[model samples]
Target: MKIVVKIGGKNIDFKNEDYFRVLAQLVKEGIRLALVHGGGPQITKFLEKEGRESQFVEGLRVTPPQDMEITEMVLSGLLNKMLVGIFHRQGIPACGISGRDGFLLEGEKYYPASGDRKVDLGRVGEVKKVNPRLVHVLWEGGFLPVISPIAADREGESLNVNADWAAARLAVALQADKLFLFSDVPGVLRDVEDRDSLIEVLSWAEIEILKEEGKIRGGMIPKIEMAEEALRGGVKEVFIGEGKEMENLPLFLAGGKMRGTKVVL
Candidate 1:
């Protein structure tokens, strides 16, 4: 079975050997996996170092041209290689790449809701299509495909994409068995601030109601939306939660009990 795991680099501590070892175990167990990663914290650090402030609309970054440049540098260049290095240390061969490589992610300009004025989000782009051939090739070659979220526009210009949405699109295109969005939180909580309020499972209708009631906001808004998109696109199952939930990957694929919030149709 194939799985797509999107991990927030901010939450992952590469210094911890145990963390990467868990992932290496996945490969040892014969799971074909693709890792899509986000570098929000690292991007913010780069922007700050350059004396530029970061801005976000809803959960999306407002990437000015300069910001996009920094984003690509941090994501595709820095963080991507870092993750690959971690996997390598764990005895796993990994190919680090960005969405722009091999037409992995094709994108177009994205305009967010901002009334009639149409605010320019710079190089921010949403996934228009995903080609999973490269990912499959790498997986079959005994390598993990570690991907960055920077994609190319129709004109071949680089565009910044939300890694969560990008991973969802990849899962859909690859017909992956499962998609996991790992972060710091345990899962979707009834209250964003209350860790104990984690919701174990949610149907599309319940997710919609929670969204309507303003219970799901900030980063989670995009996560839930992407989970819904993945489910609708025919991915067998979707999970969003802390990285620890990865331990249950085998159980999840085997249709056994697993941790974290499961999104259902």
Candidate 2:
């Protein structure tokens, strides 16, 4: 079974051996999967060390040109290779790559919506086209790809892309059987302030109502939107859950209990 998994940077931990073991086990079972990772925490830490200020707009990082180098370095270099190393320790042969390599994720600069004008998120991009050639080649060679969400525009300039958006795009392009979005939150909640209000199952119609009622807002909107897009794009299933619950992959694919909100069409 082919699956696409996107992990939030906050949830990534060197101590989190359970997560890597789960993924390695999946690979051992012959389940083809690719990992797309975010490195927000690492990037912020690096920026602070470099005396560069970090900015955000609408929950998305405002990556100025100066910060772009650090962002790419942290996301595509350090974190990506680190994850690959961890997987290697588990006996999983992982190939670390960024969206820029082989034009894996190609797009244009993204100017987020502002009140009247577009907010310039310098060096940020949207994934317009996905070239899965390299991914397929790696898969054929029995290598699991661990990707960093760094896209390139038409001019071959590197642009930071959100990991969730990147994973969803890759899932669609690969026609993956399942798409998993790992978030800091446990799941989609009825009340953002209440962890117990996790919505176990959700539908597109319900999503609209939730948005109208303001139950879903901020960063989660993009995640939910990506889930919906993945579903609409022919992905058989889209799952959003707490980052730690990534261990539930086997159970989830086996139709067992999973602790997350499953998005459906």
Candidate 3:
């Protein structure tokens, strides 16, 4: 199976090797996997240490020109290599890469459309195209690709992209069978405070209604929005679930249910 998995920054706990172990097991079982990761928390920490306050516009970080350098270093340089090293320890031949590598992802500057107030998200980009050759070559050569979401603009400069959206575009380009965004939450919940209120499945219509009803807000808004784009872009399945639920991926693929929400068209 061809699958794209995304891991969020807040969920990057080295102590919890369960997610890594599960991914390794799947790869050993002959699954073609590509991992896209984000280091938002780490970026924030480093930015604050440099006296830059992290700001956001509609859940998307409002990066400044100065912050772009730091973002690229943390995402493409540090976190990307660290993840490749982890996969190496799992006995997997993994290659760390950025979207800028071979222009795998080329994008234009992004502008937020939701907010009533105008704000600038410097160095932020939305994907314009995806080149799948590098990823396919890595997979064919028995190497797992650990991707950092750093896009290149027309001027060949780096742009910080949301990892979830990167994974979505990559999934569409790869024509992946499944796409999973693993974050801290179990799934889309009716009540943010109640884990038991987790919604097992959501359709596009329902998601729109939920948005209007204000059930979904903050970071989750873009997560689901990207899932919708992937679904519309010809990906077979997409799931917004917790990383731990990935341990049950085999069963889920075998037609069993899991804890995370499955976003369907």
| TM-score of candidate 3 against the unseen true structure | 0.96
- For model 1, give the 10-residue run with minimal summed lDDT: 244-253
Residue-by-residue lDDT tens digits, candidate 3, 56-105: 76677888999999999999988888888788888988899999998899
Give the total clashing residue pairs for model 1. 0
What tens-digit string does per-residue lDDT give for candidate 2 at 1-265?
8999999998898887777899899999999899999988899999999888777765678899989999999999999999999999998999999999987999789888768898788888889999988899999999999999999988899998889899999999999999998988989999999999999999999999999998988678878999999998999999999888988789878988889999988
lDDT per residue for candidate 1 within 1-265, as digits (tens), equals 7889999866667777676676778888898888999988889998999999988886788899978889999999988999999998888999999999999999998888777777789999999999989998898899999999998998899999999989999999999988999988888999988998989998889998998998988778889999999999999889988877667766666778766898888
Q: Rank the candidates by lDDT, best first.
A: 2, 3, 1
71 Cα displacement, candidate 1 (Å): 0.4
**Candidate 2 lowest-lDDT run of ten:** 52-61
- Model 3 misplaced stretches (Cα beyond 4 Å): 114-118
In model 1, the clashing pairs are none
Candidate 2 global lDDT: 0.90
Local distance difference test values of all predictions, in order: 0.88, 0.90, 0.90
Better of 1 and 3 by TM-score: 3
Give the CA lDDT, 0 to 100, for residue 169 in model 2: 93
Error of 1 at 133 (Å): 1.1
Task: Estimate the overall C-alpha local distance difference test score of candidate 1.
Answer: 0.88
- Residue 252 CA error for candidate 2 (Å)? 1.4
